[model samples]
Target chain A: MAVIGVALVRLRDLFGVVMLSGLFTLTAASLYVVMDAVDVAFTEAAVGAGIATVLMLETLALTTGREKVTRRRSLAPFLMVVVTGAVLIYGTLDMPRYGDPGAPIHQHVAPRYIEESGREVGVPNIVTSVLASYRGYDTLGEVTVIFTATAGVLALIGRSRRTRRRKGSQTTGGDQDAR
Target chain B: MRGNIILRVASKLLIPCILLFALYVQFHGDFGPGGGFQAGVIFGSAFILYALIVNIESARRAVPAVVSRVALALGLLLYAGVGVAGMFLGGRYLNYSVLAEVPTTGQHLGITLIELGVGITVAAAMITVFYVFAGEER
Candidate 1:
């Protein structure tokens, strides 16, 4: 991961950067799997590695692959990153070790969810039961957020597909109404 | 992309499998480590594969942008609608016990419906975003 991060920083080509970011996502997904968060791993793999890579490639196709040079090398931003990284690392020092059962995180309602969710939610998968039934509102909000973003995307590229359909409606995919 | 016969054949073989796996993940989430969000992304990626391998035109025919747009709203509404339905059934917002005669059965039905809703929206939203981004030109 560190190697990929370093290489990503060194590479000036935007295409390489996008590919490296996909690798970075895969690395994070693998770490999630190792931590036994398979659902999270699956999401990261699908969204991060799958969709994100394709989206970035499309962006690359729209723009030049070569990154333009910055006017100056500012030490301020570098120092800021270093300080933030140091602070974050310092904060992690107080965290419990991986999979520590007695940790503060696992002491909350997780135990109750494990014990009682079967009867209440009536699902074998505790995660799904808790997520969809116990915490259904949060998921609803998330879906709304996704819908909003897609709306934004539609707004941005609304005209191009419509205009292009006039010339060769049969050949193009835009004429959905014709069928 | 359409010019490549190999790509065409390969995508044809793989797309159904990916879509089937996504359905498995969506419905089987109750018994295993899968759910709407992950299943949705996998499903969206199948269409994305079709878009990349073939022309964007055929991809649109497979799933028209208008349909994608409708799906975007439909899935979310279905989720929120379930909550509203619960309210009408005499439960508080998002309370599923009152959804049916048997509380456990109601809970089961509610989870399944909401998960289906989540899966639909996520898949539609992701695919629509991809189509817009890929089709647009600067």
Candidate 2:
């Protein structure tokens, strides 16, 4: 996957890069599905595969098609990555199995969400009940984050035609013919 | 543009079915494995298909940029509004039992509203994000 990602970066074709990114997202979503995180997998498949890929392609339309190769080989980042990988692997030695039935996660508040949530919130999908009711505030904050990101993207993209219209008719008059 | 006609026609038919299925998943989530988040993504995927099959501009016209923005805000407002309503009913924030005079089923009603809010917000936000990127110059 990493090799594919690097190859995608090196490739000049923007459409190919987008397709590669979709592949990476699919792989990640598959991993999430294997871990029983169905919701997370669904999100990765939708947002990563569907939206992000489309966005990247749109951005490609406005930019140079070819990637410029640099001669300089930066070894510092590679060294850092190796060290980080070693540390991460060492840290994972003490972690439990992927689907350990006796895991602490299954024993704690999870049971409440699974057992009591149906009676309390009256929702069969425990995840929804937890997300919308038990931890609703967090989801609200998430929505705000999305809103902020959208606003940021729009601002960065600059004012649409409406903004120029408000400024004056001078710019719009010239662009009207082009459209 | 050179793709199979069958694929195009099938996608055209499948998109609306996907959306209807998403709605079913959202509403029937209280009795199944699916819920607001999953339903939202499914719903968004349906629109994304339409955008792909028809054209981005046509999809934008169908869903409209301003309508999507309003839908996004309204979703959050719906969720928060229910919580505020709970406060007015003399309970804690999001306390659903106080929503109705009949306390037993009030929780059910509250959960439904909250789920609906989540579904709306998620679906709109997902679609809006897609639109933003789809229209981007890069």
Candidate 3:
């Protein structure tokens, strides 16, 4: 992962950067798998590595392939990154140790979900029970957020006149023939 | 493209497999460590793959923005509707136990429905975002 990060920084070619970022995501997914978070691993793999890479490649198709190197360097960004990392590390100092059974999180409602989900939710998968039943409101909110994002994207760039014209000229059942 | 017959043929073979896996992930989520979010991204990537091979315009025609738009809202509605139904059944918001006569069965029905809703919304949102971003020049 560090190697990929170094390669990403050293390579000015935007395509290489995108590819490396995908590699980075895959690494993160692997790390999640090692931590036994299969669902999260799946999400990171599918979203971070798969769809994001394709979207970036599509963006690359419309833009320059290589990055423009700046002659001047800014220390502000580097300092900001260092400060942020330090603060995050500091914040983690108070976090419970990994997988401690006595941790507050484990002592909370998680135990009830784990113990009673089979009888209550009748779902063999505790994770699903928690996500869809115990915390259905959060899932609803997440769906709504996705809907809003789609709406925003549609409003912003869903229609492109050049695409419409080219599409109209191409085939009988093209875009313009309908709208 | 080099009229890349290999890319075309391989994609044709792979697209079906990808879509099948996406469906598998969606339906099989309750039993294992899969769900709507991951399945939806995979589903969206299938279309993105098609767009990569052909063009965004053709992909758009195949999917159509209107379908995505409707799906986006419909999924959210289904989720919230389940909660509303719970209320109508004299339970608290999102109390799936009231969804059916049998509490366990109601849970199964509620979770399945809501998961399906999540799957639909996530897939639609992802596909729509890809279309907008990869559509054309500003």
Q: What is the TM-score of each candidate against the true structure?
A: 0.92, 0.84, 0.90
Q: Across residues A63-160, which tens digit of lDDT does each residue of candidate 3 receive?
A: 88989989899999999999999999999999999998999999989999998998998888788889889998888888888888778877766765
Q: Local error of candidate 1 at A59, Å?
A: 0.6
lDDT of 3: 0.86
Q: Worst ten-residue run, lDDT, model 1 chain B?
A: B129-138
Superpose all Cα atoms of candidate 2 onto the true structure and report the RMSD in Å to 1 decimal. 3.4
Tens-place lDDT digits, model 2, residues A36-133: 87767877887788767766766676676557668899999989999999999999898888778688888888877888886777766677678767
Q: List the candidate 3 regions with Cα displacement exceeding 4 Å.
A: A160-179
- Pick by DockQ: which candidate is best? 1
Runs of candidate 1 exceeding 4 Å displacement: A163-179
- Supply candidate 1's per-residue lDDT for B35: 85
Top-TM-score candidate index: 1
- Winner on TM-score (1 vs 2): 1
